[model samples]
Target: MPAIVGAVKVINVSASSIFHIGDVYAMAPKSSAKTYAGGGSFNTGSGIHIQLSDSHTYVNDNDKFDQTIIGT
Candidate 1:
């Protein structure tokens, strides 16, 4: 077996969400859904209403019959 006997420096490791350093198998894509409302920020007051809905897909399964609805 081998080992590092010196100091190690890591920089700019900007995953900010997901970071992998070692070997991996079957790395599925990270599922994500983002919903943003108009005029929604820290600069001003937001007067609009925000609604979110998600009928997420089944993970690690075969969806022979699947249905999803976001909104009306």
Candidate 2:
């Protein structure tokens, strides 16, 4: 197997509530990273949670959704 190394980063969005696992969310890129605000899938719930390899330097907020809300 290949070796992995370096820092760890994460992005999280909350729906101001609780949810279950295997839920999906539509997240926008953190205001800091140049990543675009597109539709992506997540395994967690309530909000969106993403993990990266390093720290960030910008403000971020995302619009979250589920398969039912956005449609499947």
Candidate 3:
């Protein structure tokens, strides 16, 4: 069968996430997190340190995978 789509709108899409329209068989999404640290030299013994964090979910694997079963 077929579909008649009209006025399709997509707001936003992020990494490691998927949005399908018609049909999908198999989906395998993998994501990871990483942290970075740094130190700075201060004149006084007491100092405040801050670390910036990353807020992105990147897709590690992009394999669609194999499908065996189908439906109508």
TM-score of each: 0.21, 0.15, 0.36
Clashes of each: 0, 5, 0
lDDT of 1: 0.44
The predicted structure with the larger lDDT, 1 or 2, is 1
Ranking by lDDT: 3, 1, 2
**RMSD (CA, angstroms), candidate 2:** 20.6
Best by TM-score: 3
**lDDT agreement with native, every candidate:** 0.44, 0.43, 0.57
Candidate 2: misplaced stretches above 4 Å?
13-72
| Candidate 1 residue-wise lDDT at 65 | 32
* Candidate number that wins on lDDT, 2 or 3: 3
Q: On residues 1-72, what C-alpha lDDT tens digit does candidate 2 reach at each position?
A: 444545644466455333333434653322222333333433557777776656445545564522233221
lDDT tens digits, residues 7-43, model 3? Answer: 8799998976877776567876666564443343232
Q: List the lowest-lDDT window of 10 residues for candidate 2.
A: 29-38
Query: Model 1, which residues run further than 4 Å from truth?
Result: 1-16, 34-72
Provide the global lDDT of candidate 2 against the true structure: 0.43
lDDT of 1 by residue, 1-72 (tens): 344345556665543344444555644433334444333233445576645454344345456534433231
